[model samples]
Target: MSKAKPLSDAQPTQRKGAPLPTDPGQTGYGAPPPAPLPGAPSTPLTGTRQRGGARPVGWNSPSSRRPPQFTDTTPAAPVRRLPQPVLVSAAVVGVVALIGAAILGYRAMDTFDTVANPLANPSAKQTEVPLAPPRPTVTVTATPVPDAVRVKQNGLYKAGKVAAVNCTAPAVKPSTEAAALRFYQAILPCLNRAWAPLVRKAGYEFRPPKVVLWAKGQTSCTGEPTDVAFYCGDAETITMRGDQDSKLFRQDATSGRIHAMDTLAHEYGHHVQMLTNILISSSSRKGWAKTEPAKLEESRRLELQASCLGAAFLGANKTALGITGQRLETWEWQTKHSGDEYNPKKVRDHGSRKNNWLWSGASFKTTNPASCNTFTAPAAKVS
Candidate 1:
């Protein structure tokens, strides 16, 4: 009792078996040490505490006590990733967009190919789609073949039928060269009238031949000396050797006139051959022959056909040309004399006498151009 010291400054007495202050600031045996001032460094806790003004080993100073830190040890639920349905929906959208683009590109390409390339789609069916303004149909017509060309291919020999010739005998006689030329000139119109229709019917162009009366001159065609009478297809002219044929006129006046007429008719037959393309066809065949015999046979056929054609003309115009039975016989005899049999040593170009007489007589008897198809006749007949 020293007057109990002022309680504020009192020092408490320890008591046995009494509870000690639980506050950490109390310096009791079991109490924790006081914390250090704020902002001071912290000390790690140990098992033991220091004695006599020393702090406990585990005590943290006030300076080291920082604001309460949130460590987030619970791990914040792992940021809850996007919902499963949303993620799946996004992936599906991306795939659908890619497929749609691919389909659109394929359709565009198909349309372009269909429009640009028809052959590219070989398997495409025409029936699938109707074409606008349907494709046009084309029609072709063949050209008509000419009769001359047909004859070369062994077609109808006489392309068409000949009509009857209406003519009258000319008054001019062949007693002299002047008379013979005048007689020939007078008969030309009749011959033209007789043959023109037949040639036109046969699909050939007809032109009356030009006549040339020469004396010992060369022919325009073969440059051969004009002996008696010849048809030159090169100049399309009939050359008559007035000097040579006039001797026949002196021998027998009436017979010479007939001979002259016969000669003109025979030479005109060559003109018919020319217009009918017979000479061209025969020459081509002759040049292609491999042997002399074949060439001779072809030549005989050509000459015999010409003789036949001559007889056809003479027979058709018998009344106008003064061709009586006697004159016809004489004409046939002339053809016989022109045969290769007359001179066996020469090439047998003109046929045998018998064949020549047969063809000429056939023409005189029938008076048909169709009867003059020597090209189709047998070798024996042509020979």
Candidate 2:
């Protein structure tokens, strides 16, 4: 687990945020950004591997959905608008925020948001540069590995089972910056502990990726002054705001812990993909860039998988985190709102709020990584 780092005017950037839901239709955060006005340059985004026997061979799949696709033509993220609730709350937020209220237009917003909008606005943090690609893609195949090992056919779908984790909840005021950092610091190790078992379960040699809580400036993935917590495979790090704003902060501290923990766990899920070899293989799939619709679908699969992996970890460790009764209810409600549907854009990146929560619900219910086999689910499930 990496420690917190403060950005300076001269320091380079990295991108990923738990953003503020600023879009008109957004419920919480994690919405697809506006399509570049028209002619903006595009960005590309990876796949998965294994250990021991079979090397690249696969086992029976969880679903029989058609093969997932891949692409390298993700368009430049569009400008984002501030949501009503966030706008109203901003007036009373802390004065210590180095970032200011979201600028009107697509120009700049000091921070992004949480949970749902982890990678929502790439361009939101930076003025001209686009956010990095959203995620890798996946296709389905219920059959055994047919000579090659593809993301959809990877053993992680069923074999990469997650062991129950025992998380020690860090006590803090959920809405404060100090609290955010403390919680993140406390939870990352738990996440590492939770997901590390997948390597042996799936026969992959896996290790944990660094998790960074950034205050400002560019990130490896987005190159923006982003607030959303995103996983950057390039830097092999997850960059998020030390200040927890977003719907998570909107709740009482108890509820906020669930959201904050989930946010960090979600980014860590991307690390699971990297170790599993799903991230890179997904991109190498044939004809991944054939259509924009397919690209969005692929992004959804990648993100939704992260959502499920995170949920499985948290759910299995609910007792340790004190997630029961109302606290559990808070998590369910928030996830339902964490989707691309909230963004109100024609292009959806992270799937709908309903699906986002649904996938999370599906995983936690069983606490099984196999339950997160989005790679084999039909299009409707991922969407």
**Candidate no. 1 TM-score:** 0.57
What would you estimate as the lDDT of candidate 2? 0.64
Per-candidate TM-score against the hidden true structure: 0.57, 0.57
What is the alpha-carbon RMSD of candidate 2 to the true structure?
A: 45.8
The sequence of per-residue lDDT tens digits that candidate 2 reaches over residues 1-383 is: 11111111111110685644343543443423234335433432222111121222113222223222234345545669899899777865754243443333234343445444667743335559776888888877787443225566666766645666666666655576666676677777777777766655777887777766665565446464443567787777877655543234654565556666777778787888888777666544423568888877777887888888888888888888877898888777777766654452334767777788778898887888888878788999888
What are the per-residue Cα lDDT tens digits for candidate 1 across 125-205?
A: 568667689678999899965443544443335554444577777776666778778877887777787778878777788
C-alpha lDDT values of all predictions: 0.64, 0.64
